[model samples]
Target chain A: MKAKIYVTLKPGVLDPQGKAVAHSLHDLGFDDVADVRQGKYLEVELTTPDKKKARADLEEMCKKLLANTVIEDYRIEIE
Target chain B: MKSAVIVYPGSNCDRDMQVALRKITGSEPLMVWHGDSDFDKVDLIAIPGGFAYGDYLRSGAIAARSPVMREVVRRANQGVFVLGVCNGFQIVAEAGLLPGALMRNRDLKFLCKDVHLRVENAKTAFTSHYAGGQVIRVPVAHFDGNYFASDDELKALEDNGQVVFRYCTGDGELTGEANVNGSMHSIAGIINKPGNVLGMMPHPERLIEDILGGRDGRALFKSLLKTFPLAA
Candidate 1:
């Protein structure tokens, strides 16, 4: 099985890279782009066959290593 | 003093940390690899600044989970003195040895220059040599040096006098313009509740000699000797 993890900075956390991208987009004529918050997308291969078990395992992974709960939040999608 | 400098795969400042430790204590510090789990019962352990493990995942995220860091966490909890600088600060915070997470600079720029730091708490094993409210110049070089913590945690740090340094002007005034990386409360360095472990973004090891343009950082290293005279 494969799991897709989306890691994003928590709300109120500063995203400097995202801000830089937003500035560049505005410079390139994308004025309507109000904001751009950058995040991480990770794909992991797991040997588990049970989707429920994989999700639980991935959540633990996110808590332990994938995401820093102090500044980031992560969502796991198992496929 | 028997000191150790933890060396991760891409740790660039381990040698500098070693040099600093050796210069101050007249003994070379042990270079412990990331894979190592034992601390060898050293008096001090330093996690120097650098791009450990190519800073993958996040700045210090992967290195925080390295085997050596697990040992570091255990030893730190046991009251062993730990000094984390720059990337080291990120690693310690990620390892849960300290509060707050280091994020990218608010301006999205890699900062590398000397900044002024005011000693807020001179009671730690790291800053006992610095007089209270003394301003010292130290260079900060990193992409992710902005410090962030929850409001409650910030209050707790303040209430417990855990803040050790604050970014300020050369004249020792803390102002918005003086904060280079947008750290919370302009915090440049902090110690754990017990004050045994310290994490700071500025590279004190880089300014230990007058040849390096200043010797303001030497007092920090000397403070270890003051804290533990036996280690001297």
Candidate 2:
């Protein structure tokens, strides 16, 4: 099984990189792009066939290492 | 003031800290490797600055979970004094030794320069040699030194007087421009609740000698020596 993880700076936390990219987009004439919040995409391979176990393990990974919960939020999707 | 400096892979400031610790504590500090967790306990543990693990996932993320940090967390819980600087600060925070997370600089740059820090809480074991409100010049060199904490957590840290240093003007005035990294409350350093651990972005070791630009950082080492004096 494989899991897809998305990690992002929590709302209200300043995302300077995102802001800089957004500024570039504005200069490029993407007026509709009001803002951008950048994040990380991770793909993990798991030996467990159990979807439930993969989800649980991913949650633990996110909490313990994948993300610093103080400023980031993570979402996991198993495939 | 027996002390040890944890040496993580890619840690460039380990020797600087070792020199500072040796000079002030009057004893050579053990350079314990990151994989070693069996080193004997000492009066103080110092974490130096550098791009640990090439900062692959996050700054200090991989290194924080290394074997030695496990020992660091264990020893810190028992009230052993710990000091972390720059990347060291990020490691300790990532390891949960201190509250708050250090994010990238607001300008998204690696800042390397001397900044003035106001001593917000001289009562901490790490700041005892400095007077309250004293502004000291210390160099900070990091990409992720902007401090962030939840509002409630920030309130608790402030209420408990854990904020030991704040970026401020040379004349001791707290201003937005003085906070080069955009840290919350202009915090340059903070102590954990038990007051046994301190994490700061500024490099006190880099400024410990006069030939190195200034000796503003020497007082901090002296402060630790005062806190844990050797038996007579």
lDDT of 1 by residue, B56-167 (tens): 9989999999989999999998988899999999999999999999998877789999999999998878888899999999999999989999999999999999999999
Superposed on all Cα atoms, the candidates' RMSDs to the truth, in angstroms, are 1.3, 0.8
Instruction: Provide the lowest-lDDT 10-residue window in model 2 chain B.
Output: B223-232
| Weakest lDDT window of 10 consecutive positions for candidate 1 chain B | B223-232
Task: Assess every candidate by TM-score.
Answer: 0.97, 0.99
**DockQ of each candidate relative to the true complex:** 0.88, 0.94
Clashing pairs in 1: none
Model 2, C-alpha of B12: deviation from truth (Å): 0.7
Question: Which lDDT value does model 1 have at B121?
Answer: 93
Candidate 2 lDDT, B1-232, residue by residue in tens: 8799999889999999999999888888999999999998798999999988888789999999999999999999998899999999999999999998999998899999999999999998899899999989999999999999999999999999999999999998989899999999999999999999999999999988889999999999999989878661
Any residue pairs clashing in model 2, and if so which? none
- Please provide the root mean square deviation of candidate 1 (C-alpha atoms, Å): 1.3
Residue-level error in angstroms, candidate 2, position A26: 0.4
TM-score, candidate 2, is: 0.99
Chain B TM-score, all predictions listed: 0.97, 0.98
